[model samples]
Target: MQIVILKDAAEVARYGADIFTTQLQRKAGAVLGLATGSTPVALYQELIRRNQAGEVSFKNATTFNLDEYLGLSGEHPQSYRYFMDQQLFDHVDIDKNNTHVPPGDAKNPITACQEYEAKIAAAGGIDIQLLGIGRNGHIGFNEPSSGLTSRTRVKTLTKATIDDNARFFAADEYQPHLSITMGIGTILDARKVVLLATGENKADAVKAMVEGPLTAACPASALQLHRDAVIVIDLAAASKLADIEFYQHIEAENQKLQAYLASL
Candidate 1:
């Protein structure tokens, strides 16, 4: 696990965008694992800007979203598919046909979950996966106690998660308490993973994920086992972490090492 603490949300987004920009530069046909929610919006917007500037292209890219609300069709305004369309996909050059979001309205969610995993396997797995941590330390809706080695499946959202997301729905809006999400094991299959968090609200969760024990109680902590997992956050989000100075020093040394190697 690599921790990168930046000045603020904007810097975090730009840093995350730089990773994606570099990935696309290296492999235009890269298979991407995507996420939704308020946290990743800025980074997605930055990617959109770069795409418009010809700095990166997703035309040959394929993407698989991490999760979707059960019972909501893709066309629903609140569906994750719609969220991706409005935030990243519509603005980028990615082919709609190459983008896959779990079938929220599938007749058989169990079979759909297996199919989702199969599609990912067929794409050679996700080259890079992007994530946003919930305040409760959940990743991709894998709330507390979700099996660390679980695969793609349906999960019932916890009350905390539902409350945190309630703002997205109107008072009378039908809010789904169920979701289809890629399990922690599935997310770990990606060659690289980038997780973004910002604001003071996420400070506790960020700390738990970065500094706490590697247990299922904190689902995002599973990233600790991944060979390449990057956690990017702002000062506000990183405030609760105990070893801030150590993390900063390490990042600085890594920057120097990377620069030296590039010049060699």
Candidate 2:
């Protein structure tokens, strides 16, 4: 895993967006893995701006969202499908038919989970995946203790996760305690992964993910085994990382090396 420490949230968003932009530029039809949450919204906005500016195109690309609330239909205001439509699909030239979010209203959720995995396989696997870490270090609703090699499946949300997300629902709104999410193994299958986090609230999670052991306690740590996983965070989120300065040094040296190679 490569840890990239930046100055602030806006810089983190731009850096993460540039990774996606480069992937799409290299392969317009790349299958993208997406995540939903406040942290990724800024990155999505940056992508939208690039698309509108003719810097990139999603016209031929296909997308799959990481998870969805189990009891909500796509039309539900709180569903991830609706979120993506409003935040991205609607603003880009991508074909709506090519976008896929796990079926939240499936009669047999188990079957739906299996089908979701099959669909990803049929798409030739994800070329790049975007992610946002929860305060507790959960990724894609795979809370603590999730199997390191688990696959697409229905999962029960932890109390902490539910409480953290409670703000999204109205006081009397029906909030789902269940979700369908891609497993840690599933996310690790991506050719490349970019995880973005910001704010002081995420400091501890960032520290654990970057320097913690490869244990299920922090699901995001599974990325440690991935050959190409990039963790992008602002200084606020990166505050608790013990070796922050070393991470910054590595990033600086990497930039210099890239510049040297480019000039040659």
Candidate 3:
């Protein structure tokens, strides 16, 4: 696990974007696991800017989204698919057909989830999975108490998740009570994971994810078992971590070492 504490959200986005650009350059056909929510919006925007500037390209990339509302169609404005298109996909040169999101409105959700997992396997698994920590430490709709080794499946949303997402919907609109999400086991399979968190609201969750014991009660803590997991947060989000100073010192030394290695 690597923790990067940035001065603010914009700095965090730049750092995250640099990682993506490097990955795309190293392997144009990389399979990317994507996440939705306000936390990743700035990172996506930075990627878009890099693509526009000819600094990076996602043209050959394949993307699988983390989750989708169980009852929403891909065309729905609030759906994860639509969110991807509006936020990142449409701006990049990537082929629309290469992007995949769970078929939220599939007639047979069980079969659809199975197919989603199969598709990811066929694509050689996710090269890098992007994530955002929920206030309650949930990841990809895998709410508290979700099985730690679960796979791609349908999951019921917790009240906390519903309340957090409510801001995205109109007061008159109905929000789905369920979702299809890639589970903790599936996320752990990614070759690399990059989790982003911001704002004071996420401070406690960030602390728990990086410092607390691994437990299903805080689903994000499952990342502790991953071989390669990178966590990036702004000052506000990292404020609650008890080892914040030590993490900062390590980051600074790592930066120096990386620069030195590159110079050689």
Top-scoring candidate (TM-score): 1
- Residues 107-129, candidate 3, lDDT per residue (tens digit)? 99999999999999999999999
- Stretches off by above 4 angstroms in model 1 are none
lDDT of 1 by residue, 34-123 (tens): 999998999999999999999899999999999999999999999999999999999999999999999999999999999999999999
Off by over 4 Å in 2: none
- Per-residue lDDT of 1-264 in model 2, one digit per residue for the tens? 889999998999999999999999999898999999999999999999999999999999999999999999999989999999999999988999999999999999999999999999999999999999999899998998999999999999999999999999999999999999999999999999999999999998888888899889999988899999999999999999998899999989989998999899
In order, candidate lDDTs are 0.96, 0.94, 0.95
Model 1: pairs clashing at backbone N, Cα or C within 3 Å: none
Worst 10 residues of 2 by lDDT: 205-214
